[model samples]
Target: MSRVRQILDMNAFDAATGGDGAVKRRLDNLGAASVLFYREPIEMVAARGAWMEARDGTRYLDFYNNVPSVGHSHPEVVAAISAQVARLNTNTRYLVEIVDDYLEALKAKLPVDLSNVVMTCSGSEANDLAIRVARAVSGRHGLIVTDTAYHGNTALVTEASPSALRRSPLPDHVVTVPAPGEAAYGGEDIAGGLRAAVVAAMQTLEARGHGIAAFLADSIFSSDGIFADPAGFLQPAVKTVQAAGGLYIADEVQPGFGRTGDAFWGYERHGLAPDIVTMGKPMGNGFPMAGMAARPEHLAMFCEDVGYFNTFGGNPVAAAAGRAVLRVIAAEGLQENARRVGAHLKAGLAQIAAGSDRVTAVRGAGLFLGVDLGAQDGSGAPDADYTVQVIDRMRDARVLIGAAGQFGATLKVRPPLCLSMAEAERFLEAFAGAVSD
Candidate 1:
């Protein structure tokens, strides 16, 4: 079996080698906790639309960052944030019109049953709150996740994120099942196979004296190599978890907000009404904001035991930024754009895969796609080193991308939603050259 790769180690800079003055200054400041992308990290200065400009004046088409989901430095979002902060920036304690307005607009997009929304500064805090709410409502302590899932970075969330752990084993309260993919479950029936894995995991958790509180998963399985296909394949596993007295926490940090194209939320594509939904990263078009939506009763139950508050979670500035994102997504018709452009991009990638043995597979929905790299010897083994080479090649060609999956051999292709056809074609050309070389 291939060695499991940590999420942070994928295409990361080697701090030991020590970089130039700028890199050295960054390392000195952030130390070992710093996670910089690429072997030679680029000092990004500015970004707009689908491209980022390095401090050295080279412009690279960004196909890796999902945080700026709509586009980089979107004018509307920037204006809203600036306008709101200039007027007033306050927390949830006070009655703010924009804050409630944003919440109401956001709630309309969510399942009606999830009536209460709690905002947070990041996805990590949102997930941590969701887990607590699930445990409170389900009256259980165990959790289940996919083998290479990366939920968040909080102390509690890190324990559940298998891909984030480099040396420590998964805590007993946490159990992992294989990711929902053809590799784990043959193409015959992915739904049934994933359901069985969840069942087995629940059994194991029960045996360990920790009844399953929640079955948490990134709806698209982004970190587990983006296994999004057959649309409703997740329903069976989700239903099994709910029937087993466990809540389903949909971690939409990566795949939410119309990135999947077909639906506003990734869970919607799977036909799921998740018990709790936690979202961030793309919530505010690069603004630091995240939120958890749950049934009012669930939030009430959790609140009875402990109080939850965030000083800057849903401040007016974040609300303005979020509202702008929602408005831009609708006004610009970004969802439809994602669907159309994503299809074009996927087809181009499929052609590349057909021509190259090193390109093993192409899968995912909408703008969130994953391309698996393999050994060139026809054995089709996952090749991390070759993947890094391709990443560097793409970088040299002025295209930015990153790696994911258990072996770090899958290129995570997630450009902004505003990516034009010309940009998609440009990426394909760069990708073709990267792989061919």
Candidate 2:
């Protein structure tokens, strides 16, 4: 087996083909970077709502994807994309009403101070540009993020992403702080810990002659094992950055578009307004669309120094798709649905944990929940091996899920916002069976 395949559990690989011939053929053409899930990747044919259909006619309830936030192939979103593509699709240089409409609607959801929008093709591009804007505005190059954060895949961002730095060293201009979980729980002062971390990082950066430029964080801390609780815990960190003459950049790619259910944006839940917010994933409901929202004053510096223009960003087709998503969210009341269904799902998972010895901590807000799998010996250590086994078992039970956290021992349960109560029940039942068996 190749190195990547070796990293994945061989026992979990789907042996439906009874051989590695198919895998070998695909690997020969696509190369090693083609990362796939499971010991045996599912041959998916189609998806709708919260269910994905496999080539073998198996239907798996999807609790792993947030990209299709509204739902897979939603009729309205599809119609909008089809109509716009057929009618016209052009770059942002041309005058377009749809783009203007989307920008206005999106800005309306944000704070009035964030009046500027710069569209990009992906979350990576959005973060990359946001970094540039922060550097120009603050006139500094130092950046800080969570210890295990995964911001994006661009060269500049990949260096800033500590998770991506597993194989490589982080750039000198970047600093990392412990995630909120380490200090939030365990009877520690969450805000104080966060403030100290930022202060330490700023001191180091200043000593090296690179004053703090920005303190970037994924609102949900999705990569740092989903540390979201004790709402308003992030206020101290944000304030610390501002006091140090740095921008607070909120990475909303994972927790934006009402995924948290309590608020339209995750930062809103903490009641802390960010200087710059980057969004993607659910923006176009699976379409390649992303952008950053910023306060006019902060963006003014960047605009004056070096204006940006993307070729395909904010195009007519993307705008139409974005608009349709906004409409569907309101029409279907998916945000409230997430609140209700997420609560029900979390409660059910809690019930399951109450009876099991392996399941430990259950945390998250709205539709973004994480369940921790711990050692059976009562050591409180992450049991990543057990997590892998549970994932394989859930696949057998036709429930699609995945893992996260520094050790990959936490079950990452983020379904489409449109997930129904009945689907939630079905997943709970399947999960119970997977764990009990």
Per-residue lDDT of model 2, residues 1-437, tens digit only: 10211222222344343335656666666664555677777778899999899888999889988999999888899999999999999999999899999999999898899999999999999999999999998999999998878889999888888776545777889988888885333436776778888899999888888899999998889877787787888998899899878999999999999898898899988989799999998999999999999988888889898788999999999999999999999999998988899899889999999998888878888999999887778666788878888888888888888887777788889999999888999889888887784
Worst 10 residues of 1 by lDDT: 1-10
Residue 376 of model 1 has an lDDT of: 76
Error of 2 at 418 (Å): 0.8
Roughly what TM-score does model 1 have, to 2 decimal places? 0.99
Model 2 error, position 302 (Å): 1.6
Clashes of 2: 3
Q: Rate the local accuracy (lDDT) of all candidates.
A: 0.95, 0.86
TM-score (all chains, Cα) for each model: 0.99, 0.94
The candidate that achieves the highest TM-score relative to the unseen native structure: 1
Give the 10-residue window scoring lowest on summed lDDT in candidate 2: 1-10
